[model samples]
Target: MPLPLYLLAVAVFAMGTSEFMLAGLLPDIASDLDVSVGTAGMLTSAFAIGMIVGAPLVAALARNWPRRSSLLGFTLAFAAAHAVGSSTTSFPLLFATRVVAALANAGFLAVALTAAAALVAPDKKGRALAVLLSGTTVATIAGVPGGSALGALLGWRAAFWAVAALCLPTALGILKGIPAGRAREQTIGGAALRAELAQLAMPRLILVMLLGALVNAATFAGLTFLAPVVTGTAGLSELWVSVALVLFGIGSFVGATIAGRLSDRNPGAVIAVGGPLLLIGWPALAVLADEPVALLLLVFVQGALSFALGSTLITRVLYEAAGASTMAGSYATAALNVGAAVGPLIAAAALNTGAGSLGPVWSSGFLIAIALLIAFPFRAMIRADSNTEVLQ
Candidate 1:
C-alpha cells in the first residue's frame, strides 16, 4: 500500500462514519428537530439514493479526471456538506445538506476504490482493496460508536459537527499523501474497454456484485426488524437492544478485517465460509431470541460473516473485471447502495401485519439460504482463473 492508499482509507473512514452515525443518532435528531423517527430516517435513505445515482454518474463524469484530484475535490465537498448539516436545525435544510453531502461522499468512494486498485500490484489488488475497505470497518468499530456517544452526551448536532471536524485533517492528509498518476489509457478508454466488459468475465463479475448486494439485504431485512421482534417476542429492555446493536457493529468490523486478509489469501474459501455461516446463524438467531444473550451472539456472528462476503466479492470483481475495474467497481458499489436502500423496506413490509417481526426474520433466513445456492457463479469464475495456462 502507498501513502495515497492510507489517505484514501482515512477518507473512507470519515465517509463511513458520516453515513452510518446518523442511524444511531436518529432518535435524538427526530425529537430535537420536531419530526418523527420515520422522517429522520429519510436522512439515511437520502445518502443511499445519492450513492446509487452518483456511483455510476460520478464515476463516468470523473473518469477522465486525475484520481487524486477527484478524491480531494469530492472530499472537500463532503466536508462542506457535513459542516452545513451541523449548523442547521431546519428539517428541510438538513435534508438538502444530506443529499449534497451524500453525492460528494459517493463520488469519493467510486474514485477512491479505483485509485486504490491502481496503486498496488495485480496479485495484490485484493489485499490492497481489503486494506482500503477496512477503513469502513474501523469506522463501524470506532468512529460511528464514538460519534453516537458524543451526540448522546452533547447534542445530535454535535455528531455532525464531529464529522465535519474530521474534514480539515482528512483534507490535509489526502493532499499530502495521495500520489499523482493515472492508469494506462487502454485500460480506461473507448470501445476496447467496452469489449473487455462484454467478455464472460465481466458479466460473472457483475453477478457476484449482485449476489453481494442480495446477501446484505437478506441479513439486514432480518436485523433491521430485530428491535421490534425483541420487544414483542423476546421482551428485552431498551438497554439490551442498544447493546445488541453495538455487538452487531463490532462483529461486522471484525468480520470485514479478517475476511479481507483471508480473501486475499483465498477468495473461494471466504465465500464458501460466509454463506454457510449466515445460513446456520440466522436459525439460531430466530430460535434463541428468548435468550437475549444467546441470540445477540448469533446475530453478531451473522452480521460479521455477511459483510466478510462483501470484502471477498470486492477482490473477485476487480480480478474478473480487468481493464475496466473502475467501471465495474462503480456497479458493485451500486449493488450495495441498492441493498442498503431496499433492506429496511422489505423488513417493514414483512413486519407490518403485527406478526411480532418474526415474519421478516424468517423471510430473511429463507432468502439467504437461497442466495447461498447462487454463489457458485462467482466461485466458478475464480476457479476458472486457476485453469488458465501460463503463456510465457
Candidate 2:
C-alpha cells in the first residue's frame, strides 16, 4: 500500500471519530447546552443526513475538480467545522457545525476510496480498499474510545477541539503524500454522463446498493444496543461491556484485513461467505446473549462479518461502475450511512414496542436474511463477471 493510502486512512480516522464520538457525549452536550438529551441527539441525525445527502451530491458536483484538490478542500472544511463546533455553546450552532462537518466527511470519504482504488491495479482494489477501511476500524478501536475518554476528562467541547487538531496533521499528510493531478474524474459529455447514470440503475448495481444498506441495518441494529444487551442479559458489569466492544472492534479490524485480501480474488465469495456467517452469528447471539463467553465470541465474529460485507459491497460497486467510480463510491457511502441511521431506529422501535432485549437480535437476523436474499442475484452477477474476466 502507498503512503497516500495510509494518509487517507488518517483522514478517515478523524472523520470516524467525529461520527461516533457524540454517542458518548450526548448527555454532557444536553446538559451544557440546556437542552433535553433527545434534542441533543438530533446532532447525530443531522450528521447522518448530511453524509447521506452530501456524499453523492458533492461527488457529482466536484466530478470535474482535481481529485487532490477536492480531497484537501474537504479535509480542511471538516477541520474548520470541528473548530467551529468546539467554540459553539448553542445547540443549534453545534448541530449546524456537525452537519457541515459531515458533509465534508462524506465528500472526503467518497473521494478517498476512489483515490485509493486509482492507485492500485484493478485486481487489488479490494485489498486497497481494505487498507483504507482499516482506518475506520481502527477509529472504532482507538478514535471513538479516545474521544470518549477525552470528553470525560477535558469536556465534550475538548473532544471536538481534539478532532480539529488531529485533522491538521492529516491534512498535511494528504498534501505531502498524495500526488497532485492524480485520480481526476474522467471528462465526459452529457450523453456519456447520462449513460454512466444509466449503468448505475442496472439491477445488479441496485442490488449491490441495497445489500450495502441492509448489511449495515442488520449489524448496527444489534450493535447500537450492544452495551445494554451484554450487561442486561449476560449480567456482566459495565466494564465487561467495554470489553465486549473492544473484542468486536478487534474482530472488525481483523476481518477487514482478511476480507480485503480475499476480495482481490473473489469479492463475491467474500460476501457469499460473509452473509451466511452473519445470519448464523446474530441468531446465535440471541440465544447466547446471557452467556459471557458465547456473547464475546459471537460479537467478534459478527463484527468481522459486518465489515466483510461492507468491503465486499464497495468492491462490487467499483467493479460495476468502472467509469463513474466516484459516483459509485459516494452512493455506497451514502447507502451504508442510510442503513446506519435506520438500523438503530428499528432496534429502538422494537425495544420500545415491548420487544425485550432479544428483539434487536432477532430483528438483525431478519434484516440479514433480507439482505442475503437481495444478494442472491448479486452473487450470480459477480460470478458471471468473474468467469468473463477469467476468459478474457
Per-residue lDDT tens digits of candidate 2, residues 225-270?
A: 6656766789986456556666777787888778878875677778
> Each model's TM-score?
0.79, 0.81
TM-score of 1: 0.79
User: Judged by lDDT against the true structure, how good is candidate 1?
Assistant: 0.70
The per-model lDDT (C-alpha) reads 0.70, 0.75
Worst 10 residues of 2 by lDDT: 383-392
TM-score of 2: 0.81
Give candidate 2's whole-model lDDT.
0.75
Cα error of candidate 2 at position 104, Å: 0.1
Over 4 Å off in model 2, which ranges?
Answer: 1-5, 22-45, 66-69, 86-94, 110-133, 152-156, 174-186, 230-241, 264-272, 356-359, 376-379, 382-384, 387-392
**Candidate 1 lDDT, tens digit per residue, 272-352?**
877787777777777787877787787678768877876577556555555554466666667776766666566556654
